[model samples]
Target: MLFTSSSSEKEILSIISKQLLLGSTDARHPFRFVNLCTLDGNQPDSRYVVLREFKEDLALFFYTDSRSEKVAQINKNPNAALLFYHPIERCQVKIGGKAQIITNTELIKEHWNNVQTEAKKGYQSVLAPKTAVSQPEEGWVQELKYQSKNFSIIKVRAKQIECLQLDDEGHLRIGFNKKQEVWQSTWLVP
Candidate 1:
């Protein structure tokens, strides 16, 4: 087996840290695109979002339009999940946490300035996301202005982490929970 039955908590966390680093720095990393899941009434809403930032404590950062439907869902319920997978590595990470939205702040301007011109256009949409447009051209903004007001930052502080690694020999699944600034990890069945 690739992993021993006695895998340490530190080792699991280290693996997670490496994956998070790859997600943020490597463009081709599979973890770069994560499925962000949020509650919409009693159902679930999920969408792919690029990973903007990662913190060791399992906090994640992503950008989206302030007027997006996901933002409204998050407002109603802060609980959320970020699911990531890397096919080549045969690894999957599920992070559960509370999402906090940041807008109208200096950080928003900083993030807006950092986004590429092409991507910044997403926030400049004439109408909010999920709005019906009569024509294709009517949906987008032709202006080059990078409006910070419409840029939103989502911060997710992870309360639980589930990581699964599949290999030819065996599959390993681990879970981590944070309490009082300490992390407790345990092995889970695949």
Candidate 2:
């Protein structure tokens, strides 16, 4: 496969219309991530969080404490980069966007009430992610129809997407930009 002609960005983006998190190699198919914001300035200051849902091209879902450091960072810098990888697909997707915090009590309750016990456990981590190295601990958890008002959801509005593929075709880097309310993309050799 070889080509050297300019094409409409939409033509190339058609292959990636589906919202998915794929691997860049063969050993991490399920390892997924979402873009995060931080005030630390280091690229790694960003965390790899499980993406809970993708709501069309307008929004993406993630859960967190309204009091966490990240919440503060988003309040300051809303721009971020979300990365998702799946080893089995030899694919990697990077998203650049602005993060919007959702604070509607009704919406938060709806999402929280549906959360299973295992997932609900995350609420405790907001306090201390690695407090006990090797000892018993004390903490509070939610199991009933209750959630902290601080429980928040972050929605990412994607403005650009970079999808990379590696294989027999060597490596390809494609970028998509939102233009005039439509997506336009371009291919680059990497």
Clash statistics: count for each candidate: 0, 10
Q: What lDDT score belongs to each candidate, Candidate 1 first?
A: 0.84, 0.63
Model 2 C-alpha lDDT per residue in residues 15-36, reported as the tens digit of each score: 4434342221212335335445
**Worst window of 10 by summed lDDT in candidate 1:** 1-10
Question: What is the Cα-based TM-score of model 1?
Answer: 0.93
Off by over 4 Å in 2: 1-32, 35-37, 41-44, 124-145
Candidate 1 per-residue lDDT over residues 78-102, each given as its tens digit = 9999999878777888999999898
True-vs-predicted CA distance for residue 170, candidate 2, Å = 1.9
Model 1's C-alpha root-mean-square deviation from the true structure amounts to 1.8
